[model samples]
Target: MRAILLIDDHAMFREGLVLALTQAAPDFTVHAVSNGSEAIAELEAHSGISVVMMDYYLPDVGGSALLRRLRQARPGIHILVLSASEDPDDVHAALSAGAQGFIHKSASSKTLLEALHGVIEGKQIVPDTYAAIDTNGRRLPQSDDAALLSALTPRQIEVLRLVCDGLRNSEISARLGTSEKTVKAHMTAILAGLGVINRTQAVLIARRAGLFGKPN
Candidate 1:
């Protein structure tokens, strides 16, 4: 039997998901936990766990941080982020943090099951909205673009521009005449400043804020 772990803070939502998954795949075992710590404990105790479905918000640790920790601790386990947020940035951050897939909480049971199955089959799943952003490489700025841009430093903005252009850390460092370590530092700060968790999210947020200037 396949085993899956779910981590989310809301008891009602978690219980509902557990019930839905249990009914959908009766042969498979589903376990639910309410926080990162409990999720970690469950993972450690259950060696049969093959996939982890987690929420982007946890009471104990941020989603990205928890995702990173799970990746490091169980390198072979597949993780799928199930979040209520439909924000492109949140989806990108979950994927960047090593989640195999990202699905909105509002997704239908069929879609949710498909995502879980896809992750178990070694596929990366992203919602259509996020996929569109990835394909377009830019988005129109929202009304709050100015406020978001103001939070980032000029150097951080430069780093973010390269990131939006799909440059890796090494390439970014070379282009800026800086070390890769410095580039990473800039990325970290950029994520923090933008209230994002990863490069893809930062790029998405920047693009939507008109930081890339009409994509041409």
Candidate 2:
């Protein structure tokens, strides 16, 4: 039997998907999971599962990074992404990280099933539309785009730019209309996402890489 795993966060959605798959192919045993980490654990626990259908966004692990890890752990396995995000950069990054197929959650149930069948038939897919933007989801700078832009998310990029402008956590919170803790968390994630040690370094590096130099 060709085995598969379904990874999504919503219980209702997972249950509905499981029902649909089992009804469509009774011989196919579909295991369901809640998030990327659990899906990783499931992959480790279950051998011979040939396909993985997952969402791109998870509370624990983000898209591109998770896709890379999944590919590294299960080379040659077919992976399909179902997401609401249509960010062009995200699409490119997911494909680059080794996702075999991509489909938006907004696709009809029939379309989703067809996409799954297509992947099973060795076809690659992506949404027809998406455009890359800066960390704020604004148009990325035409020139001097930072090397770090590839690493940081739109939210983290916003926080990093504010930090470079010498905004303190409280000031940043007020300016961005976010909580101080949230700003601080973004700062931390910005550093880790950039593979840097601290925010000060993160700002300087982003500026040097030319991402922060662009006008809003």
What lDDT score belongs to each candidate, Candidate 1 first? 0.77, 0.70
For each candidate in turn, give its C-alpha RMSD to the true structure in angstroms: 9.6, 13.7
For candidate 2, the lDDT comes to: 0.70
Q: Candidate 1: misplaced stretches above 4 Å?
A: 134-216
Q: Give, for candidate 2, the lowest lDDT window spanning 10 residues.
A: 128-137
Model 1: per-residue lDDT, tens digit, 50-103? 789999988897578998888666766788888889777677667677776788
Query: What does candidate 1 score on TM?
Result: 0.64
lDDT of 1 at 208: 58
CA shift of 186, model 2, Å: 39
The count of residue-pair clashes in candidate 2 stands at 1
